[model samples]
Target: MSGRLQMALSSNMAGESRNLGNGHNTNAASPLKIFGHAKSKIRQVFKNIDEYVTESDRFLSGVPAEERIVDAMQIENVKAYRGKIRGIIDVLNRDHMKVAFFGRTSNGKSTVINAMLRDKILPSGIGHTTICFVCVEGTDEPEGYLLQEGSDDRKQIGDVQKLGSALSSTKASEDSMIRINWPKDKCNLLKDDVILVDSPGIDVHPNTDVWIDKFCMDADVFVLVSNAESTLMQTEKNFFHKVSERLSKPNIFILNNRWDASASEPEYAEQVKRQHLERDIDFLANELKVCSKTEAEDRVFFVSAKEALISRSPHTSTPTSVLAEGYQARLFEFADFERKFEECISKSAVKTKFEQHTVRGKSISSELMAVLDNVFERAIHMKAEKYSTRKEHADKLDYVDRQLDMMTKDIKSKIYEMTEEVERTVSSALNEEIRRLSLLVDEFDRPFLPDRVNMDNYKKGLHAYVEKSLGRNLQSRCSKALTITVEEESRQMTEKMVALLPEEQKQNTLNFLPRRDFEIAYKLDCRNLCADFHEDLEFRFSYGITALVNRFMGPKQASMILGRGFVQNIPRSMPMTPQTPTNEAHRTMGSDDNEVLLALLATFSSLYSRTTVGALAVTGLVAKAAGWRILALSGAIYGLLYLYERLLWTNKAKERKFKHQYVKYASSKLKLIVDLTGANCSHQVQQELSTTFTQLCQQVDLSKADLQEEIKKLNKEIGKLEEIGAQSKSLRNKASYIDSELNSFILTYLKQKD
Candidate 1:
């Protein structure tokens, strides 16, 4: 073989004092072990916070809409907090120390990761070998497996060649990643929970932002593997700049790989190494400002990854080739790089990974406490307001009750007094109408042609006519006055009662009784009340003379004695009889013609004393001279008296006596029923006014009942709000305690230095 081929062939023979299995030296004394403990505690704390958020959301959602202090939007914000807390819990569960490598193509980026593992796990070549991001982490399984993004099936990684071929043959975007799970027992770095990620060349992919967001966001440290023969490229530097923008003070390391190429130029080996160191340190310390210059010196390294990888192989041979001159020294440098990287990654990952979680946990707890506190305070305020409003409603209900009670008494008293007044008015009017009963009987033009056979029917007609006329007259006089008085009082009472109702109910017409015209019906019927009435139709001397005078002197002179002024005219005709006694007796008779007829009959006895003797002597002399007989004259007189007495006098006496008896009977009957008719009218008025008052009372009572029910509901709501306030206060206190514990315990541990 040639000398270059022999150098490559003899690289497996190199061995050193250090073992590759203890690459990170992650024992009990290691910082990574302490960080892992802290990480576990942080995950538990986040899990508790996640549960708190979920419980808070459930509690807030169950509150009644009327009783809720927080609106819908704020409650939704709490639910959003639940989602954020769950996201934090998921991140905490999968947390690991990650280190991503970035560089131009063929800068030995994959070779650097393989050397760290002390095995060629990642594909490395002279061109762009890494087609997509490849992540290598530890798994507890005995067999290794691979998982590509967007798929769940595991592919067995039997060997590096097969894994490399699988990665090379895959059609994946530059941003997509392949997860490689190697047995943790084989690599100390993987055993310490270190995940190494190798990316496609920075110069090959333009989507560095996507790559950083998708894969590098959780990375604890970034390694920039550069070719030792060239200067640091801008494409490689820009990737870190973008990374620093997303992460605060990201941990970065510079690896000057392929340093063995400088062996051919021995004269400038020191100069080239010095130049690469200065430029890389300036890029990190001055340009990025991620760390100071002293910190940057420890972060940069010059090593040969190929030589380091070959030196770690399980072989024992001494190679003496030209290219293998400084292999042992390069292997030492790689070991030193691993030691420093372990320390840096352990401390940095603890702060970068868990620090953010702690900070977010503190913020979420504080915000939750604030939300609970706000809810508690709002509940307290609402509870107080409800109590005050309930008190107002209760007071209003009591006031209305009192007003209704007093108004009921006042209205009832007014109705009683008005009913009495109606009774009195009806009684007085009925008495006045009864006193005019004779004129009413006279006005009956219903053709009462009385005879012996039709006497009963005539009496019935007269009785009905008097009853109807008296009832109509009494109703006309009494109804208007009583109606006016009762309506005015009822209207006033109605207005007072309506005022006691609720504001909304006051205008509702259906809630109250409608107004109607007030009236008391008068239905007096005296059809069969009188049964002992008798008319005097026997032959009387007075009726015979009155009929004879009417027949001889014409009907006009007789009507003067029988008409409405007959009693006054009778006193003038009987001048010789004591006038004062006769007028006094006539006045006592009162609308009856019996006393006048008796006086006239007594006066007719005197006509036969002195005046009739002289008239008979002259009449006897005239009859002898006219050749007429005394018997003929006597027969003519007898015939005239018989005709007048049987025909006109008997009928007139029967008709007049019938009227007089009917008037007397009707007057007595009307007087007897006056109190009863007045009482009925009064009772009717009482019923109307009482019913209106009763309805008004019902309306007031209904309003009072409704107000009382509302007060009860308000009291219930106040109690509910009180319970809600107490629970919210307790939750706020608990959340505040958790926030303090997170700040004092978890944050202090995450921020501690290695």
Candidate 2:
């Protein structure tokens, strides 16, 4: 056989060779026949090799393979070429990988990255410095700018000056998101194959959490930086737990910074470091320790980012000297960084294999596939059953909605009634208070002045007395003018009270109390009659009668004296009456005077009795109105509760729909995988099938994994829906119970009144 054919056949012997040694020797055959047989076998081998090479070349057409090495020496290189080709094919078809750096505020995360890159591009401080995610990749130009959301336009930042000013400015709004790009020339550390992302610092500020959550979800590798002083704090632990659960890819690297500071006492620091590493391994399973590049002693480089930037500029080389002194330390750090980087890259390759197994074919072994299929079928059956449960929940929610609708209407009606009742009560109370005030004033005047005088004259005398008293007091106190102007001040206090009601209540009584003339009046009447008699032994007795009439009426004035301290004292002066002398003969003729005295007392008693009764009636009406106000407030609360219930129901419905879609998509994907892998066929053709079948099987496994994931998601959604459904039912039942109790109380109150 030719050399090429021999090599191809020998290389494929393990995978494709078949034995034909039984009674197949042909040494006795003719020389021409032997040559012909060998030629035919060689042709067959060449055809196979040509086909395999063509297929491989087609698959890896655009993939870069310069970095890939098939063998260490020339002897095994030919034999290993096919295997190398297969590996390349697998890698070329795999998904792109990503890594993220995240941690608590002031953890020196940025500094560690600077140490890795041997330069600083990210901001670091005790307070919040990083505000948004910064994606860094190898580039040729040193450029940085901000990318606003919903726009393709980028705002160019000329230098660190703009970036620093933007970060430090008080006017920086929420819309400010920045992307910094620096060239390898500016910072040699940035030249690397891996993409590095510096996410907004987590747990530093409330606003940054949102950005971290979104960025971390898509991360393939998460490098968590924890400070030596507070390694694995509650927030850090919680964050790691969440990340592990959400992003199941196993590429996680934990770096403990500020180890030097923590290691002040060598033994203690070493113990603390070991303890931290053990704790992290327990929690995360992958962790590392590194001294913070920003603060290190004894061959430790304290990177001054400002100095590094200055060195890069053409104006001066001052920063160059500072960096040169620490070059040896930086070199050591870079060596360590290179080792870590290589380790991470190797782990990424393994992860790629895992991903390929998941997506390219059915990764589950035959026994595992059978078990999983059984489990999946059972899950499908469970989901079918859940349809009924979901329907039941939906029906319950619909019933609740209907009940809420009825409740809302009932509450609205009660509110209207309560509002009207409150208005009536307030009006009655105000009128009663006004009437009480008027009667008190009338009683006061009756005792002080029995005869009616011109109102103008009376007011003039009252004003003169008040002015003289006020003038004296003011003169004693200060040198200010005593301006006493007693103009009648009338207020529609009932109208003001009504205005305080809710807008809905105000609208309900629009007709009764129009906006332009919204006032209610209370009427009060006062009549005074006085009689005086005097008896003397020497003269006939004489009696004189004086009568005064006044009327006071206006809107309720309770508010006018609401906060004022008055009506605590009653005047004691008696009314003035004309006097007459009495004699022995006059004593016998005193019947007329006696009759006058009796009439005057009867009038006063009647007036007082009527006024007291009116005040009591008004008080009772106001109390009833207050009861209505309470009912209205309760109705408003019920309305708000109903709205909340509806929102919850809507969210539950959305979750159900999402779960259904996820299930359907997963099922179809699994079916396609099973068909491609030919997992349910006879075993006769299995041997003839190439690794293509295995690869396809791995793909099927990925689809099944996706299906399992969907199922898990569905289960989670179902649990949430169940929780909300139960909560809603409980709330509704409680509300109904409360309504029943309130109704019972109202019934009792009304019956008592009856």
Candidate 3:
């Protein structure tokens, strides 16, 4: 820590406290002292906020228990609020601060970091440089490095020479970011806390804005580096001005680098420094509205980063201290600026951050409560009312039962018709797709294993080409065909189901039909059918691509090849069972995310090559006995593989024999997906209809006694929550009071004019 900060911290007088209805008198305290007091009180108040979030997260793990109980948005709101509250917990636990450096090209941002670290850790240069963001975190060790970028795994580097090459854009992977675990004892400013982020220059690169966007969520303080040679320009002002919309202007620091250059003529240096500082003060005061000119004067820092670096370098003859030897004039300027920078960061309020998080939590919680109340009024109330008038709604429920029966029959009929249509469409499209891919394969007339080039080089290029070719073939011919078939079938299925639905009938007496229950059940059935159809559709798509790749490439070659694009992306396993306890209609959910598709693909791709090699080796004796010729078609994907089983499995001399094999293979996989998918869809539909229809009948069968008993349970839970709310109201009142104190502290201390 710097001398001034340490002195200020030591001078922070601990005050006597007496609680006066959650609003203590903090009259004699300075702003920083008030911050310490208020933060403690605020943390205590947020404990209740924590409990509220924990309880809600547990109760609403995957809420509504049944979809009939609440709408999708209501369930979604609960999860959203739970996430926001958890975010508040994260904010409250943050014991460290993060600072970022942003400026135009060659503004000495990296040099500033190097000077601060007291080591040449970052690469500093002129012109447009620094292609990626580098985040340096304080560490206890000498030095450790994490080199991260692109799809490559993070490489840990301890060697200083290796780290140098990793930092360069051309030498390193694209989007490489260096995470240096810099020793805390080496740097005074970032000793026990600050995580400094250095970004690429703002206006030079084409992707400068995109690279900067990644830091928007993390940056707490921005040190805007400006050259001492120039005044604050429009682009620099505009950059800070745009950022001030999101980040508070008061937290910004103006760092003027290369101050030693201006000091060549000592007489002119003071005038030059004042001119730059004055312009910057005006920009921050008027344009950014951060502060008035007088308040902003001390915020602009002019420093000689080069001089500081020279003083710190091991080869330098000058002593380490700025005042020692002949270095007083050159390096002392950097030391004074560094002290002020440390002071500015040390004074930033802890509560100013938590206040935003608290507000976010409160907003989310309020929205969730509103959603819950609305759901209670609509669904829960109607269920209770329907129970009271059960005797009158008997005929209405009977009519609903008949309609459900008709809906089941119509759905079964439509599904079969659609499957037949899909079969017919797939065969024609599949044949054409096979022809298209086969032509491309035939055109590649190179030796299966090239005689000239090495095997490793041939294997890598060939695998990429095949994966690319299959990807293009899948998108253009295979998946598009499946997409079209699914759309037509789905449209026809919806039309038939809608035609089968019964119209609502008027009742003579004052009665309420279980309309909500029936609608929920019907939608659930519709949802299940669509889910099954889509899963089966994707499975068929994957199977078709596998078959196409198998036919032209041969099963031996196809098994060894990795399929990366389109239909070759093996479809995710159909979630026939509910993953969550609350959502009993798990089978009723359809996901386009293909949640586990990539993981399965990665596993299968690796295993595909190994397993085929193993299987072919085991069957080598059989191929030798049958005198099987090596297939020349599979040179493109993976290097080479041989399948001896094919020698006896298909007789190319007989057309009927070849046709039987293709027909058998295609029919078996398609039928397997259809059978499994249809069974899951049909079973879920029956189970869901039985469960939901029983619920509707029970609601229609409820006696007044049953209704009264449920109301008692409902009111009891409500009363408990209301009691908790009262306590919450008191704590929030305390939070509000302390928040007011913090605002007062800011106004009373920070904003006071000189």
Candidate 4:
């Protein structure tokens, strides 16, 4: 051990001392003061020494030191002192320990555990000894309970026999965990110290494999029990591989069970035992050989659970000697078993302490070195690299800036032209078609009205003539005159309007116009004309006109117009007025004339309305199409240009950032090293150099860990953003469909009108 370690241990043995300051009273030089003060001071000193040794031991054992020094003169004294101090401290703290037992199925695993406990809590047989994982701790109750996953509720295992039934009903597999707490009355057996976890048998059922694996991983010390009959089976090898990967520190305990079977041929048995031990050691290095419950030490005894329970009743007389021998043999195994168990526990504890010490030392050393090399040295190198890369990126960004500007100008100009072109095409086509139809209809002249006296004045003269010649027929005579004049005018207008439209254009226009529009326009024209005359006079005149016109020209005009046909035909007869009483036998003849006049006006209004509506619809369609086309074109151009710029320039920004961070870290480490060592140093400065080197290593490790964490977070965020972007695309596609539908409707309407 190093001088420091020896001195610390010796000081702890000396004892400790204490001091209490005095204010006034001394009791006149009392004899008690001299001894009391000295004893107190010694005790205090010892206490301080004990603390120092404990702390120093922990530090040395946990950390790895430099294996070789550059100067041979320094190596023997310095490194040896450190190593000896570390080893001594490590041994001192390993008295208390924990061990975890594990192995494959039918490997005498439970047998060995039962031997250690000196009781049979676990079932022993062929298929599987342990169905569920059980953690056995020294307690007051020999009770077992089941803990459920994701729940805090515990169910008591009141009966082991009923366990299988309960689990079967619930469909829970055999691998389910069962925790058995030893009764407090029996706590003395275990000394209330060690915690034994009897894990579910490995290779029991395929379904239970996961639980077995989990138990092995969580175990602190590994006890691998293989049957003496078969040492290291294929299943056992597979289990070992898994344990080796997960556990950093593992101790192996091998049990050679069923020694009674070999009693008849001791020599052959010994040879077989030796062979088995060698094979097991090769498989799992550093394994302890343990005998079965029947042959082991007195403290580590086991009983055949089935026989013990069955033979408890006094009905049959079985030899007490025979049972006593069996029980004695079981108890004898306990002594050796307990000793081995204690040793295994102590060694495992020591190993754990050693591991912890080494880990701490290496951690500190690595951190210092990493900070100096990666953080400082790399930082400076990266900074120079970043400068060059940033310059190149800047040039690329400038190019993109120019491209974006040019793209904007080009897009705007193209959009304007597209809008103007669509608008002009739709408007000019629709208007020209409408105007041509209108002019054709206007070309025909109204019929020339012959020179005739005012209708009322003529009517009076005619009445006088009629009364003088034929007194009773004057009304009839007046009617005849009116009829002839009306007929003549009606014939003229019909012929003129019919000739206005070309045969083909007229048919196409009539087919295209809606029926409702025709009805509305024709009604308006008739209403205007009919309202101009006195009601009674207009009825007579209108009736006479309709009848004469229908007889002379209605057939030819109707046939020609109907050939181009609207949805419904105009009726020759007028409808009866709803206001007329059903009981009336006589009615005025003028009612017929009123009906006829209304029908003619309604027809003209309908046709005119159809033509006007058609024109408006065409104009609206053309304007909307032009607007949308411009917008769509503009959007497309903008999107493409934006993507182009991002692809070319955005990546450069990320690369530059990465480089900058690397440079910053490296520069910081380099600066720290220079600051710690001063600008100029002699070659012989060994102690100072070693201290600086150690500090540098620790810093570098810490910095590297920080950078790794930062990078991990960045990658995670990038993945999340990409997922969100994918979801956005789906929504955008649905929205685009709706927009297209609306645009299509507008375009169709416009084209139809044109």
Best by lDDT: 1
Cα lDDT tens digits, model 4, 503-548, are: 5544553354223210000011212212222212111122232344
Query: The CA-based lDDT of model 2 is what?
Result: 0.40
Model 1 spans > 4 angstroms off: 1-28, 61-63, 68-74, 125-128, 158-175, 203-218, 229-250, 260-269, 287-289, 311-329, 354-356, 374-726, 745-754
How well does model 4 score by local distance difference test? 0.40
lDDT value for candidate 1?
0.75
For each candidate in turn, the TM-score is 0.48, 0.30, 0.40, 0.30
Question: How do the residues 1-754 of candidate 2 rate in per-residue lDDT, one tens digit apiece?
Answer: 2232344345334332211111111232221222223233333333333344443333222111321211123213322444543454444333233567777876766666654444455565565566555555555765645444455665654433234332655323332444455565543324333456765556754554455466656554677777666657777766666665554544566666655453246557546755775666655533222222221111111123233333333443354444434333323332333334444443443334333332222211122222222222223334455555555545444454454455446534543443344344433433333333323222222112212354334334433433344333323432221111000000122233334333555444334332232121211111100001111112111110111111111112222222231323334465385345566437635754553544443343334345777545644555577876775676577667656655555433433433343334323332333322222111212221222223323433443454456555555545533443343344334334433433443343222322
In the predicted model 3, the residue pairs found to clash are none
Which one wins by TM-score: 1 or 4? 1
lDDT of 3 by residue, 471-548 (tens): 454346434554454445444544433332333311211134222221111011212222222101011222344665
TM-score for model 1?
Answer: 0.48
Please write out the lDDT profile of model 1 over residues 320-425, one tens digit for every residue.
2433566656666676677678789888877767777788888878887777776766676677678788988988988887887787787778878877888888
User: Clashes in each model (backbone N, CA, C under 3 Å)?
Assistant: 0, 19, 0, 66
User: Candidate 1's error at 405, in angstroms?
Assistant: 38
lDDT (Cα atoms) of all candidates against the true structure:
0.75, 0.40, 0.52, 0.40
Better of 2 and 3 by TM-score: 3
